[model samples]
Target chain A: MAKLSRRRFLTETSAAIATAPFISTSATRARAQESRKLGFAICGLGRLSESQIAPALARTRHCRLAGLVTGTPAKAEAYMAKYGVPAGSVYSYDTMHRMADDPGIDVVYVATPNALHAEHATRAAAAGKHVFCEKPLEVSVERCRQMIDACKDAGRLLGTAYRCQYDPHHLECIRLVREQVFGAPFIIEAGFGIDVGGPDQWRLKRDLAGGGALMDVGIYALQATRYLTGEEPVVVSALETKTDPAKFAEVDESMVWTTRFPGGVVAHCSTSYKAGGIQNMRVNAERGWFELDPAFFYNGNHGRRSDGQEIRFPEIDLFAAEMDDFAQCILEGRPSKVPGEEGLRDVRIMQAIYESARTGAAVPLA
Target chain B: MAKLSRRRFLTETSAAIATAPFISTSATRARAQESRKLGFAICGLGRLSESQIAPALARTRHCRLAGLVTGTPAKAEAYMAKYGVPAGSVYSYDTMHRMADDPGIDVVYVATPNALHAEHATRAAAAGKHVFCEKPLEVSVERCRQMIDACKDAGRLLGTAYRCQYDPHHLECIRLVREQVFGAPFIIEAGFGIDVGGPDQWRLKRDLAGGGALMDVGIYALQATRYLTGEEPVVVSALETKTDPAKFAEVDESMVWTTRFPGGVVAHCSTSYKAGGIQNMRVNAERGWFELDPAFFYNGNHGRRSDGQEIRFPEIDLFAAEMDDFAQCILEGRPSKVPGEEGLRDVRIMQAIYESARTGAAVPLA
Candidate 1:
């Protein structure tokens, strides 16, 4: 998968958010509107929201960019004008729930940094809005479960932006491994790391990004491990390394961890911001192997079987698929490919990696 | 690249031993005129030696079958007859050095259990014979270094069979990363793991296999990180895991390790014989990513740029290249591509992994 460039990422995320649907008390009309065209209101219009999410929404066919929610009035007005959003579509974070009163907006896509996800998503769920948020789910597992529970209580859907699960190459890998072409896979190795500039970035802030690249990109690998193996990790061990205490004052620069399942399979993963850019995953079995690379990025991918044949999949827009799937779920009243529990499980594992990294030992997740 | 069957491995090993020149002195013009073929004398015809090594040798062209070294006289006699070896070529471990007295042999390939490599190779080196040994080099880094120095002093070459380094796909990945195609990589993820059979195997005996799969297959990933990046890891942190104490009596069943180089490049590697098999290596750099799949296995491989174009290379026999390189090093008086010091460095790092795994914190390597 190609790494979504900052500009493209924002554009894609925006597009996805704009087309997503909101929850309605009346199922019949809501489902009709949802199937026709889902409208999304984005909660944050910062770099990620403006550059990727908005553009993604604008480019989406199943959804439309309905509204903007920003504390900054100027940004809200400017973003609405740039995307041709109507004047009634603008709302501040304090008044975001009022969007429920507007028929234009169907879903609330929270694209803020890690810490804001829980509050924004929970409030969106309360207002009877469908929720789609970026990764880490929440800074804590408890908070993530809370989001899930709130969404359940409100009868609104909850989904995470685990794009890799929708990625064609990754899906193919999962398919092959599931088929046992490799013969009882015993190990899964996954990792993602990048040189994410200075401490000025929101990711460097523990309060904002939760944990580092592991939260940002590494979680994809962890999620991939689970999806590929179809097993839950029962135990975990980890090691964390940081070069400069000042640079990595709160979050880690890099980490290596292992997750053990009830079966003999172990998933090993590594993540680093200190390293330039890295993303990859490998699955090895008795008879053969399956792998994906540039595993974690948003671009094209390379994959093959242990028998030396390329695994080909008809290319589809991953972001589009994710958006369409969510829309379809809402239209059909079904569950999502990456539902709340999937998000909860990944967050749980991410937290375990942090715990293991902190204690510098094997942490049993039991 | 074919996985060598025991018969082929031993036949080639014996061939490499039998048809060769002396370590200290070349054969006379008349003797050299007979044939410039490589011959091997294998000391232990155990399963691994028989299955992988012998089959690999039979497939090799640079060497021809020469002799067998076994404690079982009947077995040795049977193998010689089966492979069409002459009667005088068979010898037991105690009489292996005396094979140097024969003009037909040139190298002594040590496929014995781990703890015996030092004594066996030391004797072979002292006997003025080139030595080909399996990994772990020896039980200790000090012993590994001693093996290196002894071979140097005796004017005999020492080569460790790090087969992955000879793989075309792996070499291409290393080349791309080192050339900065990925642009000064920051994080490296690599690992080897497989489900081991009954716990009573020699690998469970610390004195025999030296360590578990970390010393066996995991070392491939370690050497891979070093060769691919062309950097020495400066500091280390790691964690080890085992399922049952009784079953994991001698060595650990699983490990997760990290090596931090001076420039903030961290190589994270995990190894396990008790886990599912998942072997792979990935280098994440600023510009892009490069990865290898089925990393250590002979056949399965896929290498590519982050954009997913298959990085192409001329197909060549990896084992043949390894054997041929050793032959050239011996013929042209060049150093081995995978030399003793490289073996020693990995062992040093392995020791640090064990330390960190034990102490539950980062351990620095000097």
Candidate 2:
């Protein structure tokens, strides 16, 4: 019977609802027991870890930066000072296994380059810590399988940092296609291209980056096809073009590939280090279509449908959501939405794409 | 100095320049003799001919709709009445060759279905009239070559109705790529798809439509690649998916293809009959990129460069520009920009695409 201001009403109602279920003494005890946050020790001090993951930890409710691991002592010192990490909690790659004695660290987030993902993730699991590795889970399918098995054997949770899987616009696009809102999708066009300047970058190195644009950014295009169709591709045919072979001597400069799904859906995709930045995906169906330009960016992703509908969602911290989701999965004793198997699927497809490009033939996937 | 309005200034300046070049009386007479318009006889009273070609004739500076050919008597009656064409100017398809006796009809524009283009174009050429055939030229490479030979034997110019060639936006895009405005284009993504309704439509018949969406609309995607790169694809790999077999029993429902150019550039393209309308072309180069959505439409085509430059051109009647350009070629005793040879190149590429799709291997273009 009281007329309250909007802010006052919302605050009082939320407080009352929050404490309503804990009124019983047993419920209060259970709530307290389940509210602990996970401590994440990031394994790499690269741009992604320093600029994205560490800052994301500042915003995450269920995860916090508790420790640091780096091969460079300078990087370790810089990250520890920035995040207020205790000197006792810092470890080098050689001493990473010593984290087993540190109860403060719960999960090791492997933010290393593509080639070192499996090594870091496997060691983290062996140390009895949960593992969350950035995409692609590993450079090779076999290595991805090993990482998955190691986590399973250690009875630790494993998650791939496929942040787009938690993005609202991408989720809505997937939902539209899965529900056949536009009628069964028959064609998908997805591409991700970025101009990687300087030939001395790690991405151009065969040992460090694994492949070229496909490994670094083209995986986003590959992932878009799978999630849009919600099915595995049965066959892949690809072509590779290297205009500057001297500059791209170690890996492909650009690649174009076609993927055929089981339900008669075909995806035409491309990735290039030689091209200017472009990230977009389009799905055409029997009745209509939907698309997103800049689909896989950290933010500013918007979508449009054939029926004149625009898909807009509130922007959230992608890394924060991804990290918090993995921590919540560990707390709830559930498997990750983007599990190691999901990363393995993409690795197998990437391998097949490379094979098809090499042999100039269509490679059938198992 | 004269105080002249803008229009009067332009007109007086143009006329004074014209008279200065024709100071001699014979030169003035010769200039008048060279300015007569060409007569265009549309050879199919279908939707495109009725709505686009006939209306465009009203706007052309050097071409006029002087006659009509149709199998349906009612369509002929309707078009003649609508355009104020004399009854004597109408002829049935069986009697189209009699147009040789009518000197008023200078060219026959073949606007029939894909399979009927060869017959109509050849007959028009044999009737001592220049030919302007619609795209895909005739469906098959052999038919296209034969049409070219027929026009050549008759000593008449032949042009394929690739209206996009006359479109200013397309011309600007092509010019940018040809001049290496953004550096040599290394990747191209082009697609054309439309939701063709009903199984009973002529496009669903292999005999009438020649080969479904590729013959009807996919030719645009193929043309975009060639014009943008100014190079032919050396090898092509393709895949076909027919989701609705019952409705698409005689033709492909969807197709995705990859092409490799001589300069190590790759193109990924797709076309589908089951998709909602989508016509777009994007070219990515080493330095920058450019793209056009609705790239192959009759109008409403706009483009943008990666450097934030928007390619905005004044709207012009597509059919009018295409017809006038062909007429000017004939008047100047030269070849058309979109000659029969250009159409043959596309037909060969389309054949390779279909072959690769059937064989599941890359087919080299000869």
Candidate 3:
């Protein structure tokens, strides 16, 4: 992640040097050139922020932790103490509009819960900072569009953090398929399942988490299917099963769905909150098959071909890579590879899956 | 296959002796007691008959090859040369009715092309012999029912040769699932695919073969799902893809289907004629997972559980076991475990699968 960004940084730096002939104050120019890396404010310091994103900011070459946004003063104090953020840089979610006056933060990474992604993202955009949000962008398609439209109205870039899009193993698998190394991939079987916590967890609430396992981990499989084939599913048929009905009354416990893409490719995908160690993605092609056992993980992953060739690549910090890539997109004034539209696409597909499961029928996408 | 049969053979032989006091003529009783093994007439001298079933008959303890029914004199001569059979016992497809006069042949094994199974099975049943038909039963559900009805009308046992039902590896896997060794299995992923022959082969012809991969090989995956779960699918959604339209104009080259069972269990299945060695069956339960790699093969199969235990079983002639079981069922005046009803179930499912593929929608079964 750093290698390519550094090369681009040097090239852009030389370009900036060649155009530094304006007669402005030397001090102002010095401040302008102080840090080439983008500064990010983390919105919502929950488990993801505490475990992955905050640590990742320290490792990214093109980004740094510059601010914190939360309603809790204790979380703000701990984040400030550990990451060395100034007292003035920490603000509550209600006072986030004051960040428009602070030039330190160039982007806001929304690590809030699923339902709050739209609110945080739009608030960040209104504060004149670019927004980088987590997966399942929001619980509903309408909310996802609101986040996108807010950024568009505020003239700020909006990126959805699809972590696997930046992972080397995933990239390698996508490359092999796009290169026709395994022929045109016609069938893909991808699933992610992990036994979740007790019923009191926020993930068990339909209003908060959207739809349990399908929203949390299953979307990873859904996203992988889309990126792996570079195609959108035209139709989907799904089945939702629950081992415990009372525990999963508000959400799906297990879901299995099959879909057909526009170009003859079909996928069988599954997800669950009742089974563990069921994470894997397999692609069957014209020649043979290739798969990633434990395909989606924050720790590490392994991918290999049917003929026994490992999809070997260095395991860099995936969190750092995605953040830096989004930062790089902000720096270059370019739309991110996974923009808000991409996130909205997944939300729409997921809604269709839920609809199919609920209706006990196949759902067609327009 | 022989070990269990030997035990049963001994038990049945003792029972026969216990009832021998009512014998009227010693010559008639001696003839009845001469051979406990059922004599089989192989109805078609095809590749499966020549390679697996004929050789398997040599290994079975309760069955023997007593007749050859075929129009090809050369195949008959070669089979006769290898396995001893009298010239008078050899008959063509049209003259197979003459076998009613000979009591030596007790069962007719139908190993013809997919389309001819109904005619041969019904004829064999009318000839006063039990019918042991090969996989697929027939191309259409109507024809399959005809075979079943004809056998019922004649009071002759009709059994479908589902070899995997007798395969030790598959049986072991089924046993593990049934015993809840991996917890109650709620999801199964099963597929069988082989790069079939060119366009000249009967498998590519719509008339002789019902479908390409789905019939020739894919049915194994479909049947495995049924046996592993012991539940009939309630509905089926399917997709069929062909890499070469002209070559597969008459049949399906590749097919992927997803189905839901009555008890919330779902299956994702695929079959192909353009991809080789894509055969495997994996079942995911509440606790963990278990799988059979290369699950459907005439050669061998390996099944392993996720908790690091082996579902190990001794490799035996699956063909021999299925034949012996059918013969034993005849001797005991009972139905074979995999009787006409079981075969009809698979045929109905596959027909639903094909219908769903053709209509590009889900087909619900009654």
Q: Pick the candidate with the highest TM-score.
A: 2
Q: Among all windows of ten consecutive residues in candidate 1 chain B, which has the lowest summed lDDT?
A: B24-33
**What DockQ do the predictions score, one after another?**
0.19, 0.53, 0.54
Q: How far out, in Å, is residue A257 in model 1?
A: 3.0
Q: CAPRI verdict on model 3?
A: medium
Judged by whole-model lDDT over C-alpha atoms, candidate 1 comes out at 0.72
Q: What share of the true interface contacts does each candidate keep?
A: 0.23, 0.71, 0.45
Candidate 3 residue lDDT tens string, B1-366: 465466345434533432343322656445444556777889988888999989999999878787899989888998877876668789999998998876668789999898999999989988877899988889988999999999999888899988888888888888887898878777788988887865787888889988778887888999998888888889898888877789898999888888888887888888888887578898989889888887888757887788888766778888999998887676655568889888888888888999998887789986
How does model 1 do on interface RMSD, in angstroms? 4.7
Give one digit per residue, the lDDT tens place, for model 2 in B181-284: 98888889888888787777778889987798887788899998998888999989998988798999998878989999888789988888887557888888
- lDDT by residue (tens digit), candidate 2, A264-297: 8899998888865578888888788888988888
lDDT string for model 3 (A132-162, tens) is: 9988899999999999999999878889889
Model 2: CA > 4 A from native: A1-33, B1-33
Give the per-residue Cα lDDT of candidate 3 at B75: 89
TM-score of each: 0.71, 0.91, 0.90
Which of candidates 1 and 3 reaches a greater DockQ?
3
Winner on TM-score (1 vs 3): 3
Q: Give lDDT tens digits, candidate 1, residues B1-366.
A: 132254345444444544444332444423432345566677788876666666666666665556777778776665675555567878888887786675556677777887888888887887677888777788788889788888888778999877778888887787787677757766677777777778667888988887887887788888888887687887676656565568878887777676767666767787877654456677776566767766677666676667777855665556556766675567555688888777788888888878866765667665
